[model samples]
Target: MSEQKKKIERLTGVKGMNDILPADAPLWEFFEATVRSLLKSYGYQNIRTPIVEHTQLFTRGIGEVTDIVEKEMYSFTDALNGEKLTLRPENTAAVVRASIEHNLLYDGPKRLWYVGPMFRHERPQRGRYRQFHQVGVEALGFAGPDADAEIIMMCQRLWDDLGLTGIRLEINSLGQADERAAHRRELIAYLEQHADRLDEDGKRRLHTNPLRVLDTKNPAMQELVDNAPRLLDFLGEASLAHFEGLQRLLRENNIPHKINPRLVRGLDYYNLTVFEWVTDQLGSQGTVAGGGRYDPLVEQLGGKPAPSCGWAMGVERILELLKDAQRVPEPDGCDIYVVHQGEPARIRAFIAAERLRDAGLDVILHCSADGGPASFKSQMKRADASGAAYAVIIGDDEVAADNATVKPLRGAQAGDADAAGASQQQSVAFDALAEHLIERMTA
Candidate 1:
């Protein structure tokens, strides 16, 4: 007897990583297209950077004490040359790195944006994932608060365009390094007094990153954090002016916001203006988007001092809100599905599909798994399932006459109530098929 074959185990995706399947692709496309158009209207151009970068870039840029660098970065040493590399956890550092390397600021300031995936190893939940996508906007070489207000206003415009509600803005000022230093000293002293109330993460970050501890999520430590010395109290003349300037711009634009003194962003590079767009819809992941000014980051990353402001919004979180708000567009499918049977009919169908496509129509040509044509009934079933507005049916008889049967698969054609029910079909010559479909669809 032949030896029994072994069964192979099924493979699954990484725990926190997820896939965006075909059924959900339309919503993703809609969201991305809306963002693209809105950014363009404001004169922002697109920029893409490598997903992998030298691990040290983030370590020194985002700060080693932060949760992302300390615990979440996906870092590995190259087996080929032993160079340490990391899949970017967040994109701000990478964006700055790219700008410096390319000398993009040589001409002048730039309004740029990026949309891509970011990696971090964390427990995935409702709105959070290990491999998530972000839409980021950066204004480089702008020193004034106008750039800050511009990016914030850009985010507000996006929210309105996407029809999302219940999201509120909160702003704060981190001041300059010296101002934060003074507050850091006082913050450490205060937290140390109530060290017993500090969570493990808070205790560990007490001296190294005291400002972050104020932004903690521990319910038990809320009281201790709220009473800790506020960073705004430590801002000097220049820093306070910048902060107030941003607020005045927001007010003139009628953007409603509150000052959250504890709004120190996660990265170490941020200074001066900081803000977050929060919502109650997504539990625990209430912060859908957040960012701030990181004027010193270019210099910190070995480039000449250049001021920059930017923000990143989580794609999954925004998509979830879109679905929750029922604002998703209809699923994207072909405008026409070509269903045919018989070897000769299939060949004719392929030709017809190409002709229709050449007319700027979206078309799907049917096929069978075993290279033999499926029954007309089976192909029609698929045509209906494709969400196609119409199906072009062909068979041996139609192929002989060089004609195709055009059947409505969706909504009723003008003056024909039963057309959507597939009760209406007409034979059209192959040459005039494209125009015929166009006229009927328009009707």
Candidate 2:
């Protein structure tokens, strides 16, 4: 009796998690490389921590009432140990945990940066994803607003380097905890007075996090929020002084900015200056990057009290802006593509490819997708499609002569004497092939 075969089910990625296909991988590489170089130039070193942590790390550091901890976090119980764990919704809390665990502040202050994926359980949209990547920096042990201004200026420099514009800065001082307490009292009172005007989300956050109510996007509550008590008015003498000092430095450096009274960032740990770099390009999701001073987060997470300020920018959001600005970088194509057929020619092609690579050239050796060697005509088609500048061709005839024909596949490079449409070919001996290709490429 013949047994019936069971059909296999096709699997797909999780709902909001996306794949960075080959077509989009180049842009991601370009963005990451540019950010790495920029952070290095600013004396910021990289620090990477685990993607999962104790669930309490965020509930304690980011606050239990905040949206991230309450509704957006991906939390679960470890099946083996019954311990609570969460895929980090953001990097700042985890960074603080690492700094505390490692005692990184033992020697004065440290300027550190990180880049990796973050997970959030939310409906994915154009610029928002379930799994997103962020590039952030943290400067620990810096008490003054100078560290704050330096990081802000660093962001400005990155924008200029990347040739991006249309993003503007908005700054606000959350002041000290005492000052925020005073503001919170008045803010709660005011919201209660207009309790009838509050929406479901606004009413829910009215008492627990009154400052967030002022940040409501509900058009119906705009008037009530706009008329609410401003946090700036509650800033005490030293808090006002620090805020003013940051402004002076920004003005002297010619960095344009504004102060928004309702700019309480969506986190509980922030205490002093808070700022955001926002853009209109992405529609509702306008904030591309934001961070501020959290002098208490170190101690809150079990480290000795240390002041820290940093910012994190969305990699996907910034890349979208780059495309909107028509600044997408070209894909990285190899300098040479080696195409060969027949067993003897294939062996020689492998050796030639390695030699060229040893000479600091990018090369791709041709091979059949099927188990057999592809035809010469088919291989030539791939060599052209690969975007390689030159094709190193070898066949049975050339293999017997111990030679390979180097032909320009994409026309002449800069400074070459050949016309735009001309193809130039040269036969070179196997022993001197690498040197010959190098000289021609450099020329």
Candidate 3:
């Protein structure tokens, strides 16, 4: 192989994909941890499914005409066998596939949640990546507007807890399949009247999925789209009642929302209530999370008929908003840094580090040796950079004496010699190190 080609191949990641470096991980952890706790409190049991699924799952689940299955999915055939597999474009299909294959709905309702990477071949931009992460929640069975409202409420709680502002809740109902079919015929007829003004993408979807045409971003087609037959106006008795019940529930609970007639889920399976959480803070791409009822997906995926409603939030986009709003906190690092000089001190430091770990403290052992122990000044610098609360300094004299120097690194408690402005050191016996750290950290 050419050296140039080999070097190029080794140095770069796939375009549009990204790595979450150490500094970026704390925000991700905070978001994931918060979502986990929220989901757990709402009685959601997490279910993990494969990243690769049969190609038909998405085609049949998300619809072949939708942008996901049509243009953006990453699908390929296995070399060993000819079976086609796809890196999931979105996880709803896979989640539903798993639920059906396992007969999760056989007995009754199941509230499930999952968080993972999803693949989509797309132009990368702010808040958008080819390989992105999402948090998906599916409340299978218990078909009611209550399920829809519950998911919305959970999303609200998440934003409130995260201290997010300017995130708007916009909702609409796609009605039932029959209502949508009727709407489609009317929408297509209306679009045909102004086909010359429709954008290329809009015209392409005119017949295949006319509802998405109403969701156009083209300025030239705004008037045309705005005047297009509204889906909300076509809702029948049951669909109207369901949407009304959802609105009533939200109002009773004091959750604010705007009825966006133009709002429609990109997925073909959605029916009844569809909602999106949007914010103007993120330029152009304003949607942070969205989903709606997909009642027939369970049966469509080869399981007995079941009604399901769910939503998925883009982790990157939400984090982007949090970052733009300056809400992401710096990651907390080790609780203690273990620094030692000389052989006896090194050995004692290792043992003490292990003890600290066993006591549930995070410790960064000053491990590199360029010929001898790192200088005390250098070790202290590393401890500060580690964001640690304390540094445990052991030297030959202290090791021989069975004692160590405990130094405060940051966030000094009042009245301590270090509290007013500077760090201070206190002598601590070897055995009391763990207890001292625990007490100090807790304080």
- Cα TM-score per model: 0.96, 0.96, 0.94
Q: How far off is residue 215 in model 2, in Å?
A: 0.9
Q: What is the lDDT of residue 439 in candidate 1?
A: 91
Compose the digit string of candidate 1's lDDT tens values, residues 5-29: 9999999998889888987898999
- Pairs of colliding residues, candidate 1: none
For candidate 1, give the lDDT of residue 216. Answer: 91
| C-alpha lDDT values of all predictions | 0.92, 0.91, 0.90
Off by over 4 Å in 1: 414-422
What TM-score should be assigned to candidate 3? 0.94
Q: Against the correct fold, how does model 2 do in TM-score?
A: 0.96
Candidate 2: segments with Cα more than 4 A from true spot: 1-4, 413-422
- CA lDDT of 381 in candidate 1? 90
Candidate 2, residues 176-203, lDDT tens digits: the string is: 9999999999988888888999999998
Which 10 consecutive residues of model 2 have the lowest summed lDDT? 412-421
Better of 2 and 3 by TM-score: 2
Q: After the best TM-score superposition of candidate 1, give how far the Cα of residue 6 lies from its true spot, in angstroms.
A: 0.5
Query: What is the clash count of model 1?
Result: 0
